[model samples]
Target: MGKYTQDAQQLLRLIGGKENIAAVSHCVTRMRFVLNDPSKADVEAIEAMKVVKGSFTQAGQFQVIIGNAVADFYNDFVKVAGVEGVSKDAVKQAAKKNQNVLQKVIAALAEIFAPLIPAIMAAFVLVYLERFFRKISPQVISSVVVPFCSLVLAVMAAHFIVGPIGWKIGSAISSVVYAGITGSFKVVFGAIFGFVYAPLVITGLHHMSNAIDLQLIADYGGTMLWPMIALSNIAQGSAVMGMIILQKKNVAAQEVNVPAGISCYLGVTEPAIFGVNLKYGFPFICGMIGSAISAVVCVMTSTTANAVGVGGIPGILSIQPKYMGSFAICMVIAFVIPMTLTFIVGKKKLSMADRVGAGDSADTVDVSAEAGSISATENTETTELNGDGANTLRAFLTGKVIPLKEVNDGVFSEGVMGDGLAILPENDTLYAPCDGEVTVLMDESRHACGLTLENGMEILLHIGIDTVEMQGDGFEYLVSLNQKVKQGTPLVRFDREKIRTAGHPDVTVCIVTEEGNAKDFEFVTDIHAEAGKTEIVLFN
Candidate 1:
């Protein structure tokens, strides 16, 4: 079935061409649009459309309620109308700010963890279901259903958790893989050996079987698992540490070293997989060297079965106790060996001439240092305070109507811009857009604020989505009741970041009328506007 109808297209076209769209993204129920100019949008045309359940603009985003078929409509609209993708310049603009190594590492970890959320939720659900069934019928514990669910949960947890670790390990294997380590797939064999050495020898004897006494083996074997485990641990650690050294010395990108080191330290290995191997030349020799020694020793030690996997920290815990001593030895050696070799052999740093690829100007560097200057400029550019009086005719024709969603001056809703996940500005003062008299100021400044232009057109502006409880702590009113204000006068200045940190988007902008009863009115400015600008909105 077609996603959108001719009526929907007509409604969209009436707003403006695709160029008018600053950005477009959909939520569960609505197709959100950030417009170049809010005034240019044809809200009445949109409202009149049968397909459009309702329309409104908040946080600089125009939201059209399309119910369950939003996705289909969006797909058709983008394809047929040819709307460009979101601005990459914006993302680059955001990334220019300097972040410390730890912050970068945390950010990377957060990104890695985000994708696994759905899987985690699924696993947790399975766990809960299993528990619920077990509680209801203990005898059913061994039944197919119980074990089936338990296995489902376990497998999901292991796959989502261990897959990233394995990918990391695979990534670290690059540097050493091609170093003439002769033999049929010497790398794989070595890694397997290293894997066996840790769990079978170190863990089996020490941590796993500590509860069970195996006297015959104790008497016959001379703490066999210790050397193997030590060798494996050291090998794996060295492989990771070697990557870190190489990254510090060789990688072009800054701030990656910390994340690489942390990932290695946690033994997670995601940094290894997604980062190093993707860009650089192969360096798997370190992994083969580490894993090979561990593997050979395990084969020699007659290592049989493993209780756990070899990839991550959690998997390591499931290994037998007896082999733990060996695993520790392997880890220690692994860390020492690969790093020493990498330092001795690899290039430490690339020259500036080499670093600047594609003539992208080495001297240009990044201009994030000018952020404060830029911010000030942005504010100045976006502040709209011309000496001219209000457009009284547009204002009078703009019929006042109750907001579709409840809005309080102190409280605010997540507006339509972007995800609207951002918090609204609360502390700073809000200025009057044009020359106007305070005509309809609310009794509770927290609920709503209203102003009337000198030309006798009533316009209302609200503060927040739902922050009335705050009672204007971060916010301060600059103008008094019934005060006359010139154009561009600062009526209120709001503290945006504080309100955002408090868990609301700091987007506060002019809201014009939407009702059709008052016809012949037009909005003046673009929808997605700069921070402050003259003629923020025009009514004609």
Candidate 2:
């Protein structure tokens, strides 16, 4: 007999012997069991045993905390009960069989949001502590010292105090939302939710739907919510397509509208929503109307999704096999209604001034007067070029140079536009990397611009991730469209602090949108660079 043999025997007897256990597994300090009938297990008796520490039932599994000796206790218990131990996954699958609909929904929600719980809790904790620290600390060093200390304390608070409490609250919220959607008036609820979903995204409340959708899938084997969300994305894209058609004569408007529409169809909607639709009020409303109509159709057909896949045209793959036909019908409604409505409304609403070239209203640069005023002070002689007949591109911002792949935004990180590098900008002013003609400049937001170098390389300077939503609040465009610019010419100036205050990273990216004449290129990264004076990219 082992040290825990007698204790294990007692535990088995108290838990209704071998027949009560469907599957058993142990995780570090706990013995997890899928019970045949959880009520048959005497929880008080189990906790009273010498080896068991405490016990609780969760997600159809009765878990008994055994401290560090759980492995030994588990070994003897399985042998004494004459049952083979199963994998933890097997135990979880068996446990699911014992759960009722409500219990399964909660269990699924908990599992799905488990990864995000710590992050959500930490964000709240940090925000509260940061304000408190800034108010109390000495202003001289508060800018540096207070942030560090607040971060340390916030992490501790999140782990020790807030994490568990926040999880309970999140679970409760998910349950309530789940109940509302699956209630007697589910179809009406679906219509309301679908119509308002885009607005909810703006307020950040749409995150709750992710947890609820997982719960629905766990309980009913699929979710009706996700289908509506996918349809909404399609509607948003279709609206942009209508705008593109209306603005077909305006080259500058097409630059933003075409890409924003394509991105929306591929499941990324922010560009379309913030960059185009919200800027023009009617398109946004038309998309919302289209979404609601399709959502009603979705609920009527009882269409459901196996998972939250792509939220656009390709989202059909995520629908259940039997519901694919119904989902496709909903997709057509989403696409046609929004585009038709937007086109009809835009024809009257959009005027010649609204459809004009973006640069027409831009601050024009007088070549002679601005040439003397905006010249760089740095000496160009210090910068080096490769000896082997290679052309060099200098840094546009003074900062730590990093590979484009390291950027947080997927468009740059994944090289969707082209090869490039990024800078964690220490300063606000963006200078020309080479002598080029300004080819593309955003009018309203002024967050990004494009240049075609004398060497035929097309360079795109994007100020910050998602900064387009700022609507030119802290940005200034110094160069106008088609203007000739020499190396180190001041292009655009931005306020770094304003970008951070708006909850966006200030990593400026420089992309080679077109290789043009260059056959190949290489990026020099992981080093600090001086704007207008440091060579960062070599084209051969």
Candidate 3:
């Protein structure tokens, strides 16, 4: 209703208004409709949507591919059109009564627990083990024991529990697809989307693509729309990098390229396109090449997905398991080809900015501050503790203060480990709290990062609650382990939406791992603190 209002209105009108539709439903990457008169719909206008891979009428059903953000678009659609969503199977069983929520819940539960029932029943024979353990155990765990157990479990859960979940989800997501030109048609559509989507977005017509993807998923499982999105996104990002690669000495070009590249990676391409690439010339052409290559790869492999949220690296989750390999290959080609070609082609060349008048120049919206919230803290200096034997001095680590309990993870909430605080992050960027060497970087999932300060403090920055279950989808690590970083240095940038959509909280936990006495630490809590600037905890 908020952002997609106009888009929904435009799409409904293009599809011949709600009156032409007999029923409307959606799947992972598309919007599906049972239309009364398919001829009434403007096929030409519908095909023009940037997000739509293709459209087809099958069995009296008209479908539009929207991609991963289908869910969001569908949510907005039902509100605007008053057309309730049915199911993929709904058309087949239209005469039968719909399955109620309670029945569906019960059925789902049985499906999950049926295999475990035998093991659960067998455990009844071992009920005596519970009494045996209770009789043999010494009562009263010290405060230290509880905290130590918690720390171990948290790390173990994040390390072991998250990988299979993402894989399993990916396996399930294999049925999903992107919205735009799908199947064999994607090669053609991918190229068009990659080359033309930038212009469409500027004109505000790409919004219709979201609707197309919604129906694509509804009608044909998920769509390969994800890889198409990635191709287009990576092209934009790499092209921006390519354009400015040779302009390092030029302050104007560097200023545009650096920020544009970063934003492109985050799935926003306007800065790269309007601000630099389109304004220049070769960079935009390089982007088209990257897009075409990526699209061809996607079509060849027949990639598919459950949904494709906004594009970029984060959209990896929307991709299907079977096609992940091809998608990965596409990403490399998209990023590298354009970057390499543009850099080589524009070597030592003067910028195109000189040719255009200042009035016609695009003004860049300063967005780096929104990303760069980290800075060195005044409390970063180490202070001498009452040292009888300790070599480590107490130092302050800063960021937004948050309670571990609010983090929705049992390990931090119980304070089973040493406590610091967490941040309900305003942005996706994670920064270094102090001068340190990156000691532990959880590679499989980029949700958690750790640093060992020179003054002997080991800090853990855990992103999201239960995010390990997402494995490595939607996360990007900017710095690797053994790398030196200063206070406020950006260590990682992640897609917070990806975590939220996965049913996880985005509360980032900043932990001062308890190594010595717990009483020696005091942490700030329950406040909106700025990252890098606000002191989260001071070890006494």
Candidate 4:
């Protein structure tokens, strides 16, 4: 997948002018274009263009497949269309508009946590791997446990990753009150100062509570550390709340309704934070408060020792019974207070009803403003027969089968997307075996493509197991835009990285007719099993 700057003018011209687009949305790889009429789309023309992976219709949406380069293209599209990026002043105005302290806090949390999902998941898998090895053998557990234990430095990870982000948001807020103070580094130093002061305060409060023989903590054995955590979290959550408000007021118009509220409620914070905005510090504070308060309360109630680690929703789950109620209270308070406040403040500032999702609305935008005359290129390819005599036909789904690795070797316990049946690869450059038009190209460039052949047949070619993340690094495409490729002509060069990466035998090649109309036919080759010769699979 190449990064062609999406000329808003070119794209606008191709999609019958932007007025033709009833609405626009995007998935991992494709832009979902909703048109008032499908005929309004110059499907063949757009397909022939080199930049598009392909196009297809699914669930009433006309999808234009772009590769991993879609984001850059999208930004380019916005630029050509004269669309504006979210502005800082707009955000400041939004924050100053009408938010309470709690709302601001949650906004901060969302910003800090959203970008750190990858790192967080990496840490989580480390924990799971430790548990898995312990289950396998005692010796294995003893050998790897200490190293993994070191990775359980969750607080350190949070501080390093989230703390900086939170401070930046705080500084943005603080600038309104204190003149100057712009750099993230300066804000972070200030936050660190606050954080250091908190612990001492907690100790003092605990001792003061226990005037008789130092019973507040030493005798009564109370750990006030939880409140300190709660306080920190509240601060960050407020920031996140502020960001949401800002984004709502400032980001692109149109509402993206999604099933995010419940997800965020369950502590899946990244979606809302990343999906919404990041400039505010409040949401981050709220999130931190929620986690920290819960953590501290759990410690105080259960007297739990951190032989491993704590915090996060999972940590909240692992709390002992004595502290469970207190921790739950903290969790609820942490999420709800900030979210409610942010929503309310955002609504008031924007002078609009509460928005449910990030701005993914079904309203039409002038796509032509972005995509101009770029669609006028050639697209004459049709469902014509190649020398190989493989007529272009649609592939329909029969049933979802398991990948070879999923059934036996067990590298991955779960099955991947698409019907996981095995098919043979064509012998040569797998060209357009049928007379259909190229309809889609995947972002990963590894698998999942669509072609609408002549005679109303739709074909989907999904490449190997979990190969999407490869992002076009291995595979190479041979055909150019609007070029006629006969059946058995090589379309994509498949690399064997998927199999090699798993340390498995690479004897198998699959040609699965995994989508529309083509599943009516059966597999046509055992020639693929041949030793040392290039093998190809054909279907009728």
TM-score for all predictions? Answer: 0.26, 0.39, 0.33, 0.26
Candidate 3: tens digits of C-alpha lDDT, residues 1-540: 456676677788988898876778887556777766667888757654543434654334566655456688778887898888787777424311233465345434433333322233334323444444445555675444544554455445434654345334433433333423545565666676666765554433555455445545655777655567667878878988876656543333455567767767778665576556765577878888888878877777877778858677776777888888888898899889989888876643432222110110122111111122223322332222222213322222224465776655555665544466667777777777667777666565666666766655666677777676687799877776567776667777789889889987777766666233324566667665655555556554
lDDT of 2 by residue, 414-442 (tens): 66556889999998888888877877666
Q: Residue pairs in steric clash, candidate 2?
A: none
lDDT of 1 by residue, 75-105 (tens): 8777766774344334222332333465455
Model 4 misplacement above 4 A: 1-94, 97-420, 423-428, 443-449, 466-471, 481-484, 494-540
Ranking by lDDT: 2, 3, 1, 4
Top of the candidates by TM-score = 2
Q: Each prediction's Cα lDDT score?
A: 0.43, 0.76, 0.60, 0.40
Error of 2 at 1 (Å): 75
Q: Best lDDT goes to which candidate?
A: 2
lDDT of 4: 0.40
List the candidate 1 regions with Cα displacement exceeding 4 Å. 1-237, 246-254, 265-267, 301-306, 313-316, 348-540
Worst 10 residues of 3 by lDDT: 356-365
Model 3 scores a TM of 0.33
Candidate 2 residues lying further than 4 Å off, grouped into runs, are: 1-179, 356-540
Report the Cα lDDT for candidate 2.
0.76
Candidate 1: Cα lDDT at 500? 61
Per-residue lDDT tens digits for candidate 4, residues 339-446, read 665655553443111121111112111111112112322333333322444532211111223333433322221222122323333232234434445444443343
